[model samples]
Target chain A: MMLEILTYPDPRLKEPSTTVETFDEELRNFLSNLEETMRAGPGGVGIAAPQVGRFQRIAIVDVSSHKKVTKHHGRLVLINPEITDWDGFEIAREGCMSVPDYTGNVIRATHIKLTAQNENAEIKYFEMEGYEARAVQHELDHLDGLLFLDRLVSRRHDLFQRKTHQKKK
Target chain B: MKNWFMLALVGQDRVGIVAQITDALYRGGCNLGEASMLRLGTSFTMMMMVNTQLDENTLISVIQPTAEKLGLHLHLDQIEGELHPHPEPDVKIVVHGADRAGIVAQVTGELANAGLNILDLETGVGGSDKKPFYFMQIEGNATQGMEALQLALEKLKETLQGNIDINLSPLETFDL
Candidate 1:
């Protein structure tokens, strides 16, 4: 099924949407739509409910194919996921589907162990690092209406335009 | 909300660097954002993005003194409006090697010589007793009438003398 895509500055992009208490068909279907929408977004690595015009506590993350996965590849469907543990301070460039056309560096935990329910309603936990951790954190921030711009290190440098030349040897 | 700038302070490592600089930012009505403070041998390096609600045009003037007071070489830049379009739009290059002296200088110098504007760069240096590696991603926009980024690639390779690797590609945005 087709999913709705929310563009930048949409209020629905803010305000952590309500939680998905029931692991019902509707919730599963919404999750599917989120995945589809994420795949369709340019440079999209993850997407939360708020980004897809949904207010449910759900997000689909597939950092598997990203440059810095550093782990196995697969999609993660977080249903009411809570960050149970986080450690270390890292400054990484982050962007969002909700706030398109902008990227900024934000300080986040280098490592994160999160807990959430899978499609089967079974609680699952995962430990992620590097880009995976950063991607998950970015998606989770949407659950609270927080954009990477809001957490940007400073306003001086918005994510600069993508460089056209490769680095010199 | 206050617009912020990232201040990178690099100098001989010493005590109270963070405190003193932060105090100045606070007094100047600037808000501190994410920062990484560390000691690289004898030198201490701090990179922080700071924000302030002060008028856009007046931000640099106010922060100039704070930067001087802290003895920091400051770089204040803005991310707004349309960027100047590059006259030449189809050139790219990549750099990777072991971390050592003159890496940034040597690479940036090539871009300068070619009259190419660097659009983006990501450099990572990592090593230990067991392994050593350096990675750099550079995207460049060439000047008009200069489609031969390959020429610059050869020059860069010769300049590095086999210590590094260079790859050339067409202009494209990874958006990562």
Candidate 2:
């Protein structure tokens, strides 16, 4: 089941999500739907619960399908995710399903060590770098009621409007 | 119905320019839209879209006094058709080299020939007066795709004979 993604200016997208306390069947069910929604989106490699109007610290990431990314953890279901440590800095352009009209250059940590829970409520730790790290950071931001627009390095120099026409892969 | 106009102003760098202009527009019952305000060297420039019930003459009368007091050059033109033109850029091109003439013209000429539409561009000169460096970043849509645009840039770079460095990359976005 694919969940409906809320676009920008939807006040709920700005509302911070609470941590997931119970790891039960309901939580697992929602995670499955979130993964379906992410896969259904055009070029979407990750998604957070808040994007579907659910106020929970849950996100799904799977960058294995991305040709440029060689290092990825396949499909990761992160519940109550937290970045334990981060290092390095780089700027990359980012676009979100919520903010469909524009893309912006954002500075993010190049590497990050994070802790999250799997669908079975097992705590897991992972180290991510490069594009994978960037994707995780982007989804994590949604849990905190943040958007790429908030992290733009420079509004004038870094912000760009997305082209209306889609390019063929 | 809304009357849309493009307003342009340029003047020496000074404080309260925006405050004064906006205040006058507010008093004249004008609503502000998209705006770009920046400083170039010692001068400040502003380009804005304004919507109001006033005609050109009346609009000028409303902003004229503020413009005169600030010693700024002001121009107002009624907008026709689309208020916002040009799509977002799909590619980013960066050029760096020693200060020289024809860099912008030649580079942009190639892009134009390739049918790419330049959406935003900024150029600056740095380093000492003895050995100045020119840097430019351009965001545009490459209708012919990144490969074709990259080839065109490569050809342009060769034409310059290693005098300048040009880097072309796709402006990609991930849905996260």
Candidate lDDT values, in order: 0.70, 0.88
Give the per-residue lDDT of model 1 (tens digit) for A10-113.
Answer: 77677877877788887777777778878887766788887776777787788777654568437898888899999987665555666555565587887899
How far out, in Å, is residue B5 in model 2? 2.0
Candidate that would win on TM-score: 2
* Shift in Å, residue A156, candidate 1: 7.0
lDDT of 2 by residue, A1-169 (tens): 9899999999999999998889888887888888888998876698999999999999999999988889888989999999999999877778888887667778899999999999888999999998899999999999999999988887454435456797889
Candidate 1: residue B55 lDDT (0-100): 60
* Chain B TM-score list for all models: 0.49, 0.94
Cα lDDT for residue A145, candidate 1: 85
Q: Which tens-of-lDDT digit does each residue in B26-121 have in candidate 1?
A: 876887666677766577788776777766557666656655665666566643323223233345566778777787788777666767777656
